[model samples]
Target chain A: MSEAKFSVSFAGPLVTLQDAGRPGNMRYGVAASGPMDRLAFDAAHAALGNPTGGTAIEVSLGGVILNCTSGAVTVAVTGGDFVVEHGGQKRASWTVLAVSEGERLTIRAGRAGSWAYLAFAGDIVAQPWLGSHATHAPAGFGGGAVLSGHSIEVKNTALREDRLGDIPQPEFIPDGPIRVVTGPQDRYFAEGAVERFLSSPYAVTDAFDRMGMRLDGPELDLKAALSIPSEPIARGSVQVSGDGVPTVLLSDHQTTGGYPKIATVISCDIDRLAQLRAKDKLRFAAVSPEQAVATCRSYLETKQAYLDQISIARGTLEQRLMRENLISGWSEGDERAAT
Target chain B: MPGHAPKFDAIADHAVLVSFADTISDEAHAQVIALDQALAKNPPQGFVEAVPALVNLLVSFDVMATDHAVVIMHLKALLDALEVNSVSGHEREVLVCYDTELGPDLDAVASATGLSVDAVINAHLSGDYRVLMYGFAPGYAYLSGVANEIQVPRKTKPVRDVPAGSVIIAGPQCLVTTLTMPTGWSIIGQSPTRILTGDPDAPFLFDVGDKVTFSRINRATYERMKDGTHHV
Candidate 1:
């Protein structure tokens, strides 16, 4: 057996191993416990050319600290604009990091965003439950979260020396309101409740976790006090509890719920919803199923294109201006002129 | 039943929900089970998983491999050709220790039903239960076939912590708790068997439409069984 390479020195409130998550086991009463921000997670993997099923550390608010126990290794830090420090030198996120043996790497909380991700070049050595290494915290499955004393091992420890170029700005900036499709149980609410849900702004509450997050917004009065027979629920399901607060379900959400659902967030916007911290303003916009599907298809296409282009050199700021090729007589094909 | 079709709609961008009926009924439950069985027997392309609930089936598909439109089309065709009445589920026996010590609500249940404690136990044991769905927790089975005479509303104040293997009942439904969780249903018995083993080969013991019958066991047997590690 390979000796552990990384020892967790500090873990915030919750830090767990996450991958794409187990997809087909929802019928077995297991939730798909994947990364909260899938776009960021996939971007990190794409940044490193890592294969699927490579487990990444999901560092929550306050971030995490790790000490390299053995040989040097290459790692990538992405998501949520978290501050990455390598050997007491501040480094930008979305860039490759190198840590030598006995060096400490700390990820401190960022001003914006609630979660961050640290991914190694290869798969993390952890047992898979239901075909996923992602931790489902509520049920105490998937080995729960990584504690301060936990030692993590990667399959390939050989270090890659070069640092990948960093993007100037973080990815996945929310441009508009969260989009939703009116639901399987929209009829259960009283008249105009859905309109109120759409018009009024909701704020993320402190009562939040991987399972779901409660939103403080206008009351969504229900016609009946009783609950319908428990039915299947998906991530992004906007279920109004008995108290009338809307809760957007997330990873590790229950398979079935008795509460009534007014709408469901489209798949493309769920990652945007995951990054919102407490007190962040959130609004919903209604979209037809067809529109949502088309939007998702386009988003997937763009994501693939982005991953394909990651290997190309982004060039420095001056070179980027020249490459725009807008100005006349600025430069020719000469490498020196372009530089 | 012939000529019955489910209402198909999008619950998420990658998921489609098939509602067999608006209200929960035996026929709707049977259709849910039937659709699940048929899909399991002949799963379509890009099919991820199907979650069968009281009267609805939520089918998730890989958006990368297949679109929502394709999955909905295939599900509609499957519904048109499915034979719900022909699917037979597995039968299994469960032992419950219904002694008053383990079942704290025995007297209350008896008083509410206007029957003696022995009569309540006999009524509970007489009816053959069907697994309607699995929810709330792993291996937590939602069952039907509770005797109408003994059916009652859930407790106003739910218990804070009920141990695993606690047999609970509310209205016309019965549940065997697979994990220690808070519940509003009345605990009427205890089972020593572990329903969730986390085993890949057999993660759960019951499937939708499976037949279940409960038999009474003495306190000593319950204690012995609890002490010894038991699996379903």
Candidate 2:
């Protein structure tokens, strides 16, 4: 095990250690507390060519800063538009960097995303609870949240052979209605409740956390009882409480709940929903389960395409930029000359 | 009689929820346990996990390998082959202290139930209970079969910071708190025994369908057990 270490100079309140999460343990009431933005987490790992299931520091909107204290390791940052400064140099969100001893890396909340991930080239050296390093702070299961002054260690650090280069910013579908699969409990709602839910725009409330996101919208009237017999809930389940408010359960949600869930946000859309900050207004669009599955497959394909496109540059940044066409009506030479 | 035929609904693209009954009942609980055990014994391809609740079983699968229809098909076959009668769970004994200091709601529950404080405790002790499911928080087991006489509705407002090891009851359910959190249930007693040991291999003391019975202990014994000086 290589003895690479990074000491936390600053960390956001919600920053915590996470991997793919501890699945199959929900029956014990433990929610699989993985990354809020799973696609970004995977991207960070893919950028470093590290195997999946390794730990990543899940940074919330508050941001975090770290300093390399010992050894050397390669790190990748992905997710939300976060300003990343590595060793006094500004780096893009989806970029990989190598850090040596005494070098400082700072990440602050940027204009776009709410969650980001910092993944190391090697395995993080935190003790795993219940076969996972994902922290469920409410349950106090994993290792709890990462804090300032904490030294994070990575083992088996190996540098990539090819020098890293510029990465194209990933494109997402323009913000539209978030797709959802209506019902496991849509029957509980009044006849027009689902239609109203789909039609009305809901503002993301400040009462958001890893557990669930509360939305302020038209009250969904239930035809059935307010609370059903408690049942197992999925990550994207939109459970409506007695007050007729809908709250979308997230990664850290309890395994089961008593509220009647009207619909479940499709897996592919969960990452998108997780990125929305408080007061962001969004609508829900109903899709069939088959369509949801198909969308998920296509989403995975897109992510794979992004991973495949990541390659080390053979030339300098300017040369690499000049090699590709940058303008719609002009040649690369003209764009370079203008720059 | 056997429970109603299970109804499968797609909760997510990767998850299917099989409802055994419309409301909570022994038959539904049995069916849930039966299905849970059957799936554990022989999980199908792309099987992720099966979470059993009061009257339903939620089966999540890997979307890359299987979708809701495939999972529902697999679960239907598993259900057809399941031996419901074969489902049986282990029994566990919990030691609890029912002192007024530890159980702040004891007197209130007693008055509400039109019974003496000692009678309320006795009723709680006399009841037969089975682990219904785990939910709300880690290792928080919801046990069924709180005595009808002592059963009461959940508090309209939740009391925050209810400590771990609290023996609480609401409606027909009883739960031994595993974490300090807000609870709407009435705290009837406090258990010294650790329900959540924090061990990865076996973090929880009780499992769904486990038969749990409580034994009364004095304040001294509770203190001793809490301090690790008492073995029983």
Candidate 3:
């Protein structure tokens, strides 16, 4: 086996290797433990003009530092906001940068988002369990979280021709309350509970993790006792605990739950909900399943546009832009004037 | 059987849950099992897996590969044309050691049912149980057909760490756990079955519709089976 590409010097409190995750493992009581921000994870590769598919390091709350041990590797950082520095020089995230051997890259937490994805050109070397490399940290399965002093290997791949591209960032933060759809057990809630849920604003609490997020808000009262005859649950389920607090299940939620769920967050907005930090205000808006599906399609289309816009060609932006004859007066011979 | 009008609703962008009944019962489980088996036989395009629970079936699909409406339409047709009477559920014999050492709550369970310890054990052994669903944890099977005479309510205070393979019953269900999770159920016996192997290709040794018959065994037998030197 070839030597590891880089050595981790500081992996924050919680970091894990993740891919799209194993979806069909629910029968064995496994949750789909993919990235908290799916679009951000995809953007990590899209920004780099790399095809999506590989285990990326998901850094939570950020503060990860890595030293390039051997071999130069191209890296892209996306999702949330983070201050990224390579060789003591500040570098913008959501764009590709090369980390040369003996160099260092440090990532510090930003004020905006909760999760960030650092994807490399080659797939991360790890054993796949249940057909997934997505780390299920709670269960201690799959590629567990990154720790300090650990070395990670990146499989060899042909170097890409593209050096830089305009990072396709989300143009605008989506406005309005997070959208949700009434669930199979919506009827179990009291008459006005669903309305109360929609009208009231909930605060994201510190009691949050990959498994779920507990939101403190108006108590969504049930028509009867809260327990159901244990049924299957999916990510984004708004399960009300006996304490009357509503918890939105995330990527690593349990396969099944007995708590009555009033509504499920629409799929397109799950990433938005995941980015909400503690003390952030949250509201809910109800939509039909069909509307939710349509919204998902639109979001997917926007992502595709990002991939299509990637202009793959060459050296740094300065080098390529100067070398190309896109401008009438700009040419390689006019490099002095361009400078 | 015709009284059941299964309801299907979207749970997420890629998953829909089909409920056979609002309450748990043999009929509801039957419909759940039938739908699970039928879907397995002719799994629709973009189908991932159908997780059958007490009264509902959670079906997941690839939203990119297929539309949500298309899946709902196919599920509706499957329910309408489904023949649930011929489900071939497998039968497996489970050996248990109901001694005081392993079954710490045996006395409590026996007294709660107002029966001698041996009588409680015998009644439990005589149960004609079927795997109702797997939930709560990996390879943890919720079973139906707990003997009515031995049925007991969950403990007022749950035990912190019930060992894996601890055979327990709560309300009307028996659960064989592959995890050492906490529970409020009364522990009446201990089994020597490795329900969860953690291997993806061979994850669980049981399924939703498997018939289970518990047979009483001694500590020595339990130890041997637990060690994988003998099969019960």
Candidate 4:
């Protein structure tokens, strides 16, 4: 068996390994958590010829440097347009590369987005808690956070790892209105508050992370019978805290909440919300269930199109951009030039 | 042009909330329970979970597998089979400890109700509270029908984390916490019984309709139960 291992040469703020996520455990009060950017995570895996569901390194607002041992291993790097280096040489973001054993790979500060993914040819190595490899940043992870000097391990898989050239990045990562569905508690807010919520624009705040995105904008006046029982919160549900600052819960949100949920961001659009950086403005548009389903279908089709491709070339944006392909504009390249 | 009123309003893409009125009354609650039983006896394809709240019944399903029309058909059929007041709910008996150390809010409850500490405990013990449903925490059940003397309004401010197995009363209801929870209820006691554990090996202690009662225990009993030396 060919031996492979990785150790962090430089440690950044917050980095962890994540798979698709642990589903079917929400009944146990545990949240289904995985990569914040599913499209990027999938791209990295597709490039490495690794299974889509294996755990991979999720490098976020912070970054890291790593080195592998033994034979040359194929690695796929995707997510934010960060500066990446293989063996002291700078390379384009997104795409797979074969690094010789004992060579160091460096990831610098993120320029376009918040997080990135690094998928090795082999399965991501981590303790699977609750049937997932994703790290729960809020609830100090069961497996330790990625640290310097820790030896990485991977599972034995038979798929051949393939290297791909960069694909051309696309234009217009959409910043169009983030659509939401009027909720069970829409009446809790005043008529004007509801209108303001629909009419006004909210900007994603800097104090954002995997846990939640704090949106800053109008003070929505919500005055109802002083009591509302806390209910189970869903991902992308817009919950207004006491201060009226609307925060959107993400992958790391708590199982339940008491705050009035004025609206729920459809599952497909949530990926768009996740890609937004702090200070990026977004409009809220209410869409019917039909529209939500249509959006979801479009995204699924796009993902299938990319996965169907067998061979990829290096240094073009399409190789990375096409692979990610989240609809409603959640991609990093689109976010940068979005008007 | 819009079609004539198609019966119930759409609550969401894949779920519906049939409402008889805006508030909870005996008739409305009975109606809710009837719908719950009918749905349980025969659920629609892709039916996920059904929760009956004070005045409404919330039905959820996966839209990917089941469309809105089929779910609506199931809900309408459930209402049709619904015989009012035909359903019966089972009760849970939760064993609890009532003492100064375990019952931190005992004195406060006694003072608010103008009853002695022991009197408050006795009244609480005598009342048979029905388990409304499980929520607020993983297996934590919200129960209705606490004695009037034990009932108290929740605090203006909520605490961060109430311990696991906390037996507390808030308003007309009391709750047996199944997980470590943040609550505003008056703590009257704790239970030697653990109703919930996330691990896969253990059997689930309480269901939706099990009776729960309180039993006072000393430090020795608490230790025995804590260390697994005590068996149910």
Best by TM-score: 2
**Residue B221, candidate 3: C-alpha displacement in angstroms:** 4.9
Stretches of candidate 1 exceeding 4 Å from the true structure: A1-3, A163-174, A225-227, A311-339, B1-5, B99-104, B107-120, B216-232
Task: Report iRMS values in order.
Answer: 2.0, 2.5, 2.8, 4.6
Ranking by lDDT: 2, 1, 3, 4
Give native contacts recovered, as a fraction, per prediction. Answer: 0.57, 0.80, 0.57, 0.06
Candidate 1 vs 4: which has more TM-score = 1
- lDDT by residue for model 2 (A1-339), tens: 676888998998889999999888889898888889888888788777777767999988888989888998878888878889976688668777788899998888888888989888888888778888998967756856889999888899966534354444556433678999998888888889999999999999989989999999999998754557999999999999888899999989989988899999988899989999999899999999999998887777666666554533324446546655544422432333222
What would the per-residue lDDT of candidate 1 be over residues B141-187, giving only the tens digit for each residue?
A: 88898999999899999997888888899999998887778999988
Top of the candidates by lDDT: 2
Which portions of model 2 miss their true places by more than 4 Å? Answer: A159-165, A172-175, A308-339, B229-232
Residue pairs of candidate 2 with colliding backbone atoms:
none
Interface Cα RMSD of candidate 4? 4.6
Q: Taking the candidates in order, what DockQ does each have?
A: 0.55, 0.57, 0.51, 0.19
For DockQ, candidate 2 versus 3, the one ahead is 2
Candidate 1 lDDT, A99-151, residue by residue in tens: 77889999877777777788886668888776678888766567468888888
lDDT tens string, model 4, A58-126? Answer: 887678888866555677788768778986678756857666668888876556777778877776567
Q: What is the per-residue lDDT of model 3 for residues B87-110, given as tens digits with 9 covering 90 to 100?
A: 878888888999898888789878
lDDT of 3 by residue, A180-249 (tens): 8877787878888888999999999988888899998899877765557889988899998776679999
Residue A117, candidate 2: how far off, in angstroms? 0.5
Fraction of native Cα-Cα interface contacts (under 8 Å, chains A and B) also present in model 4: 0.06
